[model samples]
Target: MQKLLIIDDNDEVRRQLKWGLSKGGYELTFARDGVEGLNMFKKQEPSVVTLDLGLPPHENGVEEGLRCLGEMLRINPLSKIIVITGNEEHGAALKAVQGGAYDYYKKPIDLNELKIIIDRAMYLQTLEQENQDLRDSSVADCGIVGECGTMQEVFTLIDRVAASDVPVLITGESGTGKELVARAIHAKGPRADKDMVCINCGAIPENLLESELFGHEKGAFTGANRTVKGKVEYAEKGTLFLDEIGEMPMSLQVKLLRFLQEMVITRVGGRRDIEVDVRIIAATNVDIQEAMQNGTFREDLFYRIGVVNIVLPPLRDRGADIALLANYFLKRVSAGAGSRGKAFSPEALEYINGYDWPGNIRELENRVKRAVIMATGPQIEPDDLGINGGDVLRQRLHANDLSLKEARMLLERDMVEDALKRESGNIVKAAASIGVSRPTFYDLMKKHGVRNA
Candidate 1:
């Protein structure tokens, strides 16, 4: 049942609202003052709250009531708080509304009218909650699964930048799912209904890159038989994803910058300047700074498309997300392949956690798919994943025949040392790679008597 919290100090007022709002099909809770009301609000987590501005110990003033309203809203910003006030305190009622109250009710409340407002507020709150849930679910379904802090930060950035029309530049190492991030932004944005045109800047030859982006008129080139639209034209009213944008030829960068600045494009061998509205999302595996310094990439164009930059971390640095993604991929690939479902063996899981994924998520997914196809047994082994002898921790633990606590201590120390070695003794990078804070990493190093070179 929907919860309704009534925060009026007056005994008669609370009774009246309780009786009237009870008929609205709600679970009603009442508080005589702001403190009690806030406590009830937190406990009940009511979708709708009816706050009385004339609350004690200064019932004649609206300070206590306003304070309660602010605190409740702070706890749950989506809370629908309806403020009740006296006819003489019209200004206070307005002030309450300005302070984020859902609505304001005046003196001499009519039960039916107040019920209507309360019902509306409850309905809107339900809708907002549903929308939030849908967004969260959609993001998960997009194959960008990760629970690590860095991945969570990337997800937050995707949500924030998806709502705007500004150009986005995604940078990461090769096979780190830069394109996946781009697609997530496009899929969640307002332009999702429209086509998301994609073009790989590096995959295409330099001689034809311009024609591919800006279209070519009939007979413009040796093989031009008819006029054709380009990727930018097809992406009108939508998004254009330029994969490997760092590889875009310097000659074409000036043209892309022009179109970005003016929102107009001219086809090859065509005189007409076509105005196309499209958001640009570019991704690259190259270091953009180095490219710019070498004069291979334009600095102005970089700033133009990189209004917001989303940098994806390498898979090795994402800690436990490596195992999380591996399992996620196994389940998905196995299901898609019409298999009864396959799991990773303990040794395989250990290997997955231990091995460095230089190729990032792309490499993990490919290995999982290959394993599903190659494995004859129900559980995939490290050999099936093509990573032989990677489970050193598992082997070491089994060989020693140590107690559970000893095994755990040994595993922790080995993981710390391995991460440090993989990261070349960079404490910050090593700590983050193993999903621990720098201080915790330091403690582990001290506990194990491990020295860094």
Candidate 2:
């Protein structure tokens, strides 16, 4: 049953509302004045409140009633408030609506009509509460799974910066959960109620990247048939997350910087500038400083985006987070797939902990997902994960002892060898396939002393 609170100074009015609502399948509470009603509202947190403009001290006065409503909303903005006033006070009731009341009622309350209004308020309030609960629940889901000092510091940073609108630059290795941190930030921010737009800067070609960010007018380009609103525009009063921002082209960087400074943008091929209010959070796997030095990235844009910086630790550096994350992923994937519960075997946990996750949390998630799908028994084993196969150093270690340096070298060598083999000894193709530039790939080859095949 919904809880309904009625506040009115008239003895007969309060008694009648309580009797009618109680019979209408509601748990009703009454307050004889604005002050008493506010106290009850704080204590009960009722789903719907019927507020009376008239009270003992300021009977039928709009001033005290508006104050009470404002205070109630401050405490719980979701509270459905319906203002009650006299037929002569109809103007005051309209003022109440302007002041944020959900609905208003006039003198000589019809028991049946009033009940119907309160019922609707109760239903709407229930829906809003459920929506807010789901949003809060999502924040808990995005929490970083780790006990390491580095992860704890990251958590602290997230909590400290989530309430502000400052631009956040997250730098970390691929698969280190930069996007997760971004989501946590959005989920806790003032704009949590709005949408969060995530764009992958490296995925789009340079020609289309600007159009994607600033939108395009119809016929702006060959493929443009319809006028489109870009991610930045769509995320008004919300957050826009630019992932892999280091890959954003220099030309687009200037436009982006202009937008950040002016809080506005001109659509592609359009003359008018549209204003947008949005918070930006960017992330990248590459060294932005190196990109800046190479003239591939703009130095001015770098300082503009990195107002607050958060560096996520790799999964290998997070120690026991490996197993914690594994179990968390297993449970989620199992539940999502509607399969029976699955768990990791002792041997599997040992192998997971021993592994230096070059791909970080992302690789760990993939391994766990694959194990859950392939496992014939309830417990996933070391062999279920492809990492434990071949001559991987992690497979050679005992559960209690593992070497990080050897694991990293073995992982890097395996990646380079696989990329080279896949590309048939084409250096450019190999580098692109492994997400590195040709020059970087050549340096890695020299560092590892691997001659070109």
Candidate 3:
């Protein structure tokens, strides 16, 4: 059933529409003002909306109506809005249509004539919604979920770089979806139809990593009973994703550099060089610059595979996307389990917004999954997320007790402690982990009463 939302200030007009539109194959809903209308629009996602040009505090003016029109279109561009204006204000109706309303009608409303407009609006809304769904499907095909500025820039870079078979280096915190970005780059590019072979440099043993990446001939080693093709050959004319590339040993780095330069790989213990065409997309959680300085990673190899660089921002920095991703995951997980839909409690949202997600989006998603399974009630509380809910609840009670500066100091102190813990109390490593220099980390430790030693 199609939904029709009527936003008008006049009570009698709404009564007439409720009486008239009730029989027109529609689920009719009414809003007295702009606020109610927007709230309903967001919740119901109505197909068509009938909006009055004179609404609320500005009953004689079109200011509030225009604002509502803009917000409605921003929220759901596919919604069909029919602007209802006074006969004398035909110009305002035209302005509303120009501002994104589908169409407009002037003067006293005739139930029969307005019904035709409403039905037509519903038909057009259906068409627009279908087109919008197709567009969303295209974005979803890439499997990257983000609308933040940084991610937007990364998407733009991928669009530009994907057309060419170039080497791309994606660097971010461990759980920031680097592999997803790599897949998106390949999937959106010309090589999407071919295989995308992945090799985790850090996961495989150093001795086997070479065989895994560059194949092994029969009887090359004890396990090499048969000639095995490697990731490079398997991904011929496709993509080769090297996850945790920073963990590639220096010896393997030399081989990788040569492969990139020559576009050929020699099997272990085999003198024959096999030429293979593959696009390289490498990712690492660690700071490559720091690794290169520490002599663990090669600078030349970095330059070779880093023709295009995309850095994914951690979840904490993405702000509102936390809620967006949370809701997205909630719907997906709940649908998979055939479970009743549940929402996050208000306090849970507060904790979600305040707590820094050190493990990034993966942690957030894992916690949400746990909450879905473990939550005893309809609402998933901070406790359900398994991140010190009692502390968050207590902090909420005493939120007004701390001044802004005091809160900032307390959060900063905790951050320093966490960084130190994560880095095993190595101040230099801890500083680097949090994107700060050693001296600045020492100052923070000192100010927070944390022992540098």
Candidate 4:
């Protein structure tokens, strides 16, 4: 129920207004003076407030009433305040409206009219609150639950770039929260009020990619039954996010570049050029530079889109963030599943931190979501996480068996072997494949006394 505050120095008037409003299905609170009204406003956070011009200790005056209105607005800018004034105090009521009152009423209050005004004010306040909540909930650093140094740097970069109009290129492994970062930029940017259209270049077929980027006129092709605006046109004066841009076909690259350069596009089978003011934000997991060299992606397009690049570090490299992300996801998943308060067991947290996490943040979220649903107890164990409970038990049994150097050597050996397999034993490719420089790869091989295959 919506809450309403009625402030009047006259006891009879306050009681009457409170009774009438309460009968209309509103949660009502009454204050006998301007000071009491401000106190009640702070404590209850009512949606709407009605203040009488004649206030206690300053009766037959508008000074105290106007002061209360200003204080209420400062506490909650979106609050709706209706000022009540006597017939002779019309000037004061007009001044109150100019002072940010929602609406004013003459004395000898009409209960019916007052009810209508209050209802409208309550509706507007509710809408504003909901919009603010959605804006707060959509951001990553704001909603993503991480305080690691790496995450802090990421947040700082987002804050810096959100105020500019420069194109942003987000590059990271799949499921490393690329889209979340993109959303943070859009939500905090100047174009936040406009649409943020998203297009997955890899998901669409090559034959349709061009038409998707730039709209088509009626009968442009076999399936072009009607004219349709493309993603770029639809996002005019807003933001357009192109995901997996590395997968965009070469045929469409020229068209995209033309659009970027000219800030205009002609629909397929149409002659008139349409102009747009769109900010482009592209993301990808693949090596776009490699694609450029391999004759698949265009070099000019790469330079154009990568003016401001943000390479997100994968979850494994982001030490200790695994636990943070796990806890964050656990809360969300537990609430969604309607389960009892769920938390990760000590063993489960250890296994999560120790895992390679090749799939990055996305994989961790999925594991936690599943665990929340599958766990029988309040505390989720390693077994529920599907991380090989036997391995955990064996490690605990031999906790003092391995030296620090031996443990480090074993991990290094596994990583090098995996990198070699993934890169087909090419040292250069293996180095890039494992996200390490060539010098670092060579040093690791020598340290572990492994032969270059």
Candidate 5:
């Protein structure tokens, strides 16, 4: 049952409320003063609270009541506290709201009207709690979150390629999760039971890379004290994820190409050739076509590795996926860190959607992680995110040389998203906020492909 706490100083008024709310189906508790009421609030932890503005120690004023209200909110910002005041106390009521009260009620309370207000407050509180719980429990698909059309196509391609042994070359900008794609393919492929060995071509020293790829025999070099299997041999009958393959030196590229063709490798000081059965999955943030043009990458090796390609779109171009990913990261990081439930302010969301994410997913995760730690309130403002809303539009305009029509469309889409967010996903209120008819708002939403909240 939902808990409700009623705080009032008048014996007559408390009696009247008790009679009116007895059949409201609530687990109700009552107190005659701010001190007693606050104690009950802390002990019972009620979801909805009705606080009378005239309590003892200031039974004729709202000062004591407001102080109690502030304390209750401080203890639990999600709690719903409704202030009950007199008809002439409109200013005090507004002040209560500004101080974080959920809503205000006037004196001479009618049982039916008060019950309706109480019911609405209970419903909103439940809704917010359910949402927070859902976010806490929700999981992303395959450790990835994407709902846009382009991402759907990418998902389809990943499934198709995971069923084959053909080499897959994943291309994307840095921080765009190229390695994640490779791992997903390996995880879903026929070699799922086998180990998926990974090596970054650029991260290793050039002189040692060849040795690392093809194991060396005992006495092969000063440090080669014993025979060891290289990545290929270790990944036998599995997958070898060669990250930053474009960074491999030309000499090593020839060796890799030879291994791909013959499925055999000779140790550095051994004459016998060993055959290994392994699938290759390469990833690079560089442009292989440009590298090949400059004599840095080999065309023959490209064909050997790029039998199939999966290109990941950058965060900025992924449409609504940007917000989807931001929320996913927020939930994931918040749950893991054991932080209080929180959400992004509408302005902060606007900035997030408008800003150009040059660093893509990695940057977004880092920002959200930091904001989770830095935020002091229930809502993460743009300042907490280290973003300036005013600068977002300017940065976007300068980053993309958009046409006049494209710019207008961008603004329209942003306005539509911002209105929906500010209005708490209420379609009617969102439409009214932007001075548009509901049908027109729906049309604009459809044109921009903005999903309903």
Candidate 6:
């Protein structure tokens, strides 16, 4: 249940508030003055607080209330304090809000209006709490890194669905850590004790795909000299990660659909049906909708595997995470090799932030690895990362012919990327250079999948 603390000097007003707000589903507590209010606030750690501007020490002024408000917020910076002031105390009310109160309410309180504000405050508090918890968990266990708001939503989703049996379909471009997400889900789930078998559906030959999924009996095929357990059998009571599931053959998809329906499988050239319990996690770089429309992927299989879709953003979309990941990879690649304390030069970092990473994290990691080994100096230069400043402009201009819309979008992306680089990845400076509000510039950066330095 939510907690609300009411700090007021008048007993009658506090009583009325407690009675009215009881129906709002919060556990109410009261304090008579600023000192008592801060004490109760520290003790209760309430989600929302109603602070009266006139306390006993400075009953006619806002100083005591404002001091209490600052102290309460210092204890828990996320606290939502709603300051209550007299009808004529507009300046004090506004000042209270400026002093870190979530909002301010004038006296002669209408219960309904105050209830609505309190409800919104509590909701916002809940969301921020959940987001922080998700971020903490992501840092500790997810093995994924990024602090973008969109990535926070993804982290929250992962935490919510990790323990369930529902199939998860991860859609993203290549090198976006889809496999890492799959492993994180399996690791955080109830089936972590069991094996998590993985197979690259696109890497195998069409003829061997079926046999690889389900076990084969001796003499089942031309070279079937001995019986062997397939990936599905090996992953009993665990998860089966189908990487590049969109590339799975339609004929094999039919068989997979049957297995999903019956929870049983048949070995090649074997009549007996073997029951298996395994969760499915499918990932694809291709658009499954287009695959289904083209009849290359079965609709039934798609539905069975795509119950919870977690779409991973490409590396370019993860703002500021580029520098974090680059620095992390730099330390790792240099530590094991001969180099020591290798780092990216300022020019290399600018190039990293400005360039569009078509190959995502894998590409970033590979370039960093090559640079660590190839760099003659302590710092890796842009040339070491295989990037040329002017060459980038030339390459963009001469690459495949683009439509007018595509060309405009490309130019927009480049401009934002350049702004971010020029500002040393400072969001405010970059947005100023673009002649747009900070939020609108952020939206554009997100739209163009631009990451900060």
* C-alpha local distance difference test of each model: 0.86, 0.83, 0.84, 0.82, 0.86, 0.84
Better of 5 and 6 by lDDT: 5
**Tens-place lDDT digits, model 1, residues 1-453:** 999999888899988887777778899999999889999998999999999988889989989999999999999998899999898899988888998999999879899899999999998787577445444633556867777898889999999999999999999999888988999999989999998999999999999999999999999989899999999999999999999999999889999999999999999999999999999999999999999999999999999999999999999888888887886777668658877667787767766776667788899999999989977766787667876342444554566744575467557878888998999999999999999999999867654446686
lDDT of model 3 at position 262: 99
* Best-fitting candidate, scored by TM-score: 3
Model 6 C-alpha lDDT per residue in residues 277-365, reported as the tens digit of each score: 99899999999999999999998898898999999998877878887778767766765785545667765776686567889989999
State how far residue 251 of model 3 sits from its true place (Å).
Answer: 1.0
In angstroms, give how far residue 394 of model 6 lies from its true place. 5.6
Model 6: weakest 10-residue lDDT segment is 388-397
Model 2 — which ten-residue stretch has the worst lDDT? 388-397
Give per-residue CA lDDT, model 4, range 253-319, as digits (tens): 8999999988999998788999999999999999988898899999999888999988888897787
Alpha carbon deviation, residue 395, candidate 1 (Å)? 16
Residue 308 displacement in candidate 2 (angstroms): 0.9
TM-score winner, 2 or 5 = 5
| Candidate topping lDDT | 1
TM-score of 3: 0.62
Report the C-alpha lDDT of model 2 over 266-312, residue by residue, as the tens digit: 99989999999999999999999899889998988989999899999
Q: Is 4 or 5 the stronger prediction by TM-score? A: 5
Each model's TM-score, in the order given? 0.58, 0.57, 0.62, 0.58, 0.61, 0.58
Question: Following a full C-alpha superposition, what root-mean-square deviation does model 3 have from the true structure?
Answer: 14.8
